[model samples]
Target: MAVFLTLVLGSLAARATLADTWPAAIACGLALMFTLTGIAHFVPGMRRDMIAIVPPPLPAPALLVTVTGVLELMGAVGVVYPPTRADAAGCLFVLMLAMFPANIYAARMPDPPASMTANLGLRSAEEAVYLAAAIVVAVRGGQ
Candidate 1:
């Protein structure tokens, strides 16, 4: 829900305040979404939830979370800069793919996080939308 809301509201705001193009709006939305999610990595409770979602086999979940968070922040910045928008969107697309397994793992757990408790199908659909948005931003954003 957070992702959807962030993307929709951010895009709308961007459309109103920034460029009128859909690509520009999506780029802004993606940046805002990544910024929020990246910041969550440093928040105690959200950090715990993120770490918990990492598959058990991954060593040093905390470190991994921090690294991904930094990457997300970097992507956010890169996405908004015209010169780097495509590359950043491509990286974010890959990042989302790479991180999906953890989401699946979290959803399958007997007691999933409140955020992850949404049905797996719903989560997958949301991820698909996010990926599509990234692709749109990559292909047409900042043009």
Candidate 2:
């Protein structure tokens, strides 16, 4: 939210072209979020929780999470480049979908904290919003 607002405000302040501002802002906001969450993969407790949530089918859970983190950061970089923005958004859209099983698995776990259970719902909504943003960015990137 902050990233989106900042992008919108910055675009307005700079008097950016209408066609570019809106879509660029959406892509940039998601980029910021992806970067932050990718960084979160390194924090101990968060990292443990992240590793815990991986669905069993994917091999090398820890490595996978690390790789995703790297990809998120790379996507963040790609999103800022007009030429690669659509491709980045598409990859991220798929990334979000790929991560859904972890959210579902976490939601089903009998964690003692109620907040933990609810977090999955919140994440699901967030992922949906991001996915939508990605779609918008992809479409607008070609314009």
Candidate 3:
């Protein structure tokens, strides 16, 4: 819900202040969304929730969270840069795919963290929306 709202509101703000084109607005939205989420990785509560969601099989969950957070931050920067927008969007799409298993793991856990407890179906739908938005930014944002 936060991601969707950020994208929509950010797009509107971008349209007003950044560019009038949908591609540009969407790119700005993606960048804003990523920036917010990326920062959440370092916040104590959110970081704990993020780490808790990582599949147990993946060693160094904390490190993985940190690394992915950094990647998200970098992607946020890249997505708004004209030269790197499409490439960044593509990478973010792949990143979303890569991170989904953790969401599944969290959903299946008997007692998931409160922050990560969205049901599998809802989480999947959210992921689909995010992926679709990323695709839109990737395919047309370069313009």
> Which predicted model would earn the best lDDT?
3
Tell me the lDDT of candidate 3: 0.91
| Model 1 / residue 73 / CA error / Å | 0.8
- Candidate lDDT scores, in order, read 0.90, 0.73, 0.91
**For all the candidates, what are their Cα RMSDs to the real structure?**
1.1, 3.8, 1.1
User: Which parts of model 1 are misplaced by more than 4 Å?
Assistant: none
Q: Candidate 3: deviation at residue 68, Å? A: 0.4
Q: After superposition, how far is residue 89 of candidate 1 from its true place, in Å?
A: 0.5
> How much is the lDDT of residue 70 in candidate 1?
97
The order by descending lDDT is 3, 1, 2
So what's the TM-score on candidate 2? 0.80
Sorting all predicted structures by TM-score, with the top scorer first, yields: 1, 3, 2
TM-score for candidate 3, residues paired by index: 0.94
> Tens-digit lDDT track for model 2 on 83-127?
999999889889888878887888877772232344666667666
lDDT of 1 by residue, 1-143 (tens): 89788988999999999867988888999999999989988989889989999999999999999999999999999988889998899999999999998889987888887755447888898899999999999888858
